[model samples]
Target: MRPIAILSVLAGLSALTSPAASAQDRPPRPPAFASPEVTAEKKVSFRIHAPKAEKVQLSSSDLPDAGRGLDMTKSDEGVWEATVGPVVPGAYRYSFNVDGLAVIDPRNPATSEANNNTFSLVYVPGSETSDAKDVPHGAVAEVVYPSQTLQRPRRMHVYTPPGYEKGEGRFPVFYLLHGATDSDASWSTIGRAGFILDNLIAAGKARPMIVVMPAGHTGPFRFGGAGGVSFETQMAQFEQDFVKDLKPYIETNYRVIADREHRAIAGLSMGGAQTLNVAFGHLDEYGAVGVFSSGVFGITGGPNGGAPDTRWEDAHKSTLDDAELKKGLRLVWFGCGKDDFLLKTSQATVEMLKRHQIDVVSRDTVGGHTWLNWRDYLVEFAPLLFQGK
Candidate 1:
């Protein structure tokens, strides 16, 4: 063969033997780790590649029947794996504990709100109520406003229903509140309030309205400390801030019907207590009130504290007068989970309301004090607002 022909052959051999060419010839790499894989059967398989870790465990916000806080086994390749549920269709927050250190799944990008402590979020789409469908979605905006009562700046998450921007007509408003330790963003993020409202409104199950989720913490009020402010004083400040500052800001900014008949207030846990405290007194401001997974628990202090003074009930009794409440209030709903520790408080409050001859809608939903129950409460409560007005 000629020298040129030999050189061309050598070049071809080198091209074939190159690392890039050899890579193509080799077997395809295994599929990258997909943590929290929801299977067809509704089971979820969680995986994490932690080779050096001695032990890793999985903790999830799933229901008890769905196998929460299960131990994961390590594979030969150093991947920790566990499968849980046949879980019911809904969104869940989960995290991995690597040898006592709680961490989020590195492979899962979906996450809950940072205010709720930022956990890996997974949604098993099934029901139209909780799932995001091909319907017109609402817009959520994080708004900052000055709190004159608290004498500081604060943030809130506002949700305007579909067609809010183009429409000239003013809509009803739902002032929603979050639980303790959760910020204003909790409702739209972890509770999925935006999607829930969108689905309900698209299906005509609920009326389109603006939702205002405000930060429940008005000022720093520590529990059981020398310089700590009393719960009553803190609540009074919050009420002043909410009614004076927040309400005026929202009414001035948003195109909402600013009347008692068109306004509603609802909350979960700590916010629930605040709801009862604030709305029960001001029946002229809110036509509907919803308290979920909480009652007069924190207001009077939890079980550790002594029984709430009779003056507490007396004050609400004075404000929630039977004739006034009947004349102005459209709905006064209270709900708690069967497994929730606050069940007794809710039941007692319901009895008290009934004794005052004020009609109350009491719901005993399934599950504990989790976001599942809060979302369900919102679904049930939103339709009741601004209805028959």
Candidate 2:
């Protein structure tokens, strides 16, 4: 070999044998973290390999100390970890906050999507409501339909009960609504409505019905709007779309009884307010109504403005007499957690309905305004629907 080529080859060999190059050529080391591990006892142990993080904590939805950050301790390996409860059987959303920044669990793939935030999900099996049992499952579909009322396209989720494909018979329909910030998918994903209904129906505790979950927002209207448009306007548009567009679509496409006796409307939080407004206004349309963790803020206004055309209270009172209402209305169910912020409003609304000669079925559970309470409410409310029809 030439002298220059010999020197170049020696340099190349020296570089290849260097410690940094040898380290780079070696296979990467596996992660040392074991996170979000569910133990046999149902306790969830979470860990994050953030050696340089100043602090780390875990926040969860509806768990014992939900919304409050549970402090995580650091190990000698520089990993932070915390073991949460023998958690109840359910699907839960959670995230890790490291040095004031929120992030999803890198180790867990199960997640929930919301308008504002995405969270990691963990399911603990055992509870009757959340667990997947050895029973037939219902089908859930994402449906998009034109909205003449809103002058745009809208999306909804429809849940058909098991054995619906066989075309056994026309079923009752439940219009389930989500809260202010949630979308139509909230019920099926995080709320576990499908599982709850399946379990209930299989046990013969509740009647099988088609569940229609529609988007609560209508155009520019939203919860607590600050611009010239009021929140009521948005609600009115939603009610219009629900009554005119959504109802017609369901009746035309699905085998549902299109009358008051077999129709029901129910919601949570803001949706509960919408339920009171829509169901009460259309007594001839919906026989049953379930309101969870919310109530009419006042009697003077409703989804529509105070105009005679849009006032739910006025319409409800004017459309039917006491005897007619008593005969037509089947269920007026009200549910709220004992510690819910809306407890007073719910109780007051129940009293108001009773004063108006409406029989209200009231239920107070032990939790706050979380999916836990909403799931319980649905379990109780679904059985009461379409009965004696």
Candidate 3:
């Protein structure tokens, strides 16, 4: 057997040699590092155990391949391991691809859930001491509001700007949306919007404001359910939910600028399309709109068709062609990663908007269709959401 295997077996035997040996008497396990270390030179190691699987790979947003990952060498006990090169200190989320299935580390508790795959999060030390409390922090709260449109109680997330608890000032509001595969918690948990915005505000780079992240999944033309709906009908239901139900709840519960100029909507992926549909269709309600890596312009067919039809003509009729969106909208922002599959469609939308004499702030970044890109966009977009309007 290999030297490492021999050492492992010997270590295991050592624990069994003593009748009084407890779980704590065994050798301490290796440190499981996920995020990059903060020093100039840093190394990250990841491991997973799937003995029955023939192949396994480690994937991460900071690395490549949608975090789908690197191959792991199996041990006699069925554990697999891989190490990453030196990286800058920051927080990162990762997962393991076991036989083409993404899985989180069973040992780690810091996780984010959007689907079947839970993420493993790591916080690396940075320029400051790892536990320094120098930075001012904000708080997050998940809220539920009565939805008259859907006839149910809908939940959402709210991020109160730092110093909000000490002041009586009413803040402007930004309604941010998440993609199809995500829920309301994506902005605060996975995207880290609260932290990013708090940093920006503390640095005087951004003004204090309220950000409301609503659940944007709307089912078919049906009234009560919010799932398994056609793309077109889903968009319509989202509009009703936002304008009729969500807006009133925010205006009543939170201290906000309850008018058009103070309201903005932005989202990524399917949520991006929803942003366009909600803000543009109800131009009288929101003065600013943002669509990030959105696949809105191409798609057709109803629920009868496959889930993600790319025929734009059929899915986006009323909202996409509205003239008021161009006339009344104060700021329209569009962003996408240069390497994203939806780049062409984003560019095409910019051209169409320009042809209609509607100006927009178009941005491109170095990323694909991952949350890393979305997190970066949140860092850049939050300050600009309700500023000029």
Candidate 3 C-alpha lDDT tens digits along 1-389: 99999999998998787556765586555444333223345566666756689988877766533354677777776768776756544456778778887778776787765532357776554522122245787677889888888888888899998778886889989888998656787777767777777777777767788999898765422233344566566677877998898988889888999888888889998788888777656677887888899845464223355444444434445555677645567888888999987887677777666655678889988877877678677777777766653
Model 2, C-alpha of 42: deviation from truth (Å): 2.3
TM-score to true structure, per model: 0.85, 0.84, 0.76
lDDT by residue (tens digit), candidate 1, 1-389: 99999999999999999999999989655446889899988888899988889988888756443344678899877889988878778888788989999899999998876443677888888966878899999999999999888778988999999999896789999999988656787788778899999999999989999999988865444555235556567667778889889999999999999999999999998889889878877777888899998887534445677765456577776665668556888789988999988888888778777888888999997878888788889989998888766
Please give the CA lDDT of all the candidate structures. 0.83, 0.83, 0.72
Distance from true location, Cα of 319 in model 2, Å: 4.4
lDDT of 2 at 67: 74
Q: Tell me how far the alpha carbon of residue 303 in candidate 3 is from the true structure, in angstroms, after superposition.
A: 18
Number of clashing pairs, model 2? Answer: 0
Model 2: per-residue Cα lDDT over 1-389, one tens digit each = 99999999999999999999999989655367666888889998888888789999999857666478989998877788988889777888889999999999988887876644688878888887657788998998999999998788899999999999998899999999998767788888888888888998889888889999998876433446754346678678888998899989999999998888999999999899998878767777888889999987654343445522224445566543467766778888999999997887788778767777778899888988898789888888999888766
Any runs in candidate 3 off by more than 4 Å, and if so which? Answer: 1-42, 49-54, 65-67, 75-78, 87-91, 97-102, 115-117, 124-133, 218-230, 299-328
The clash number for model 1 is 0
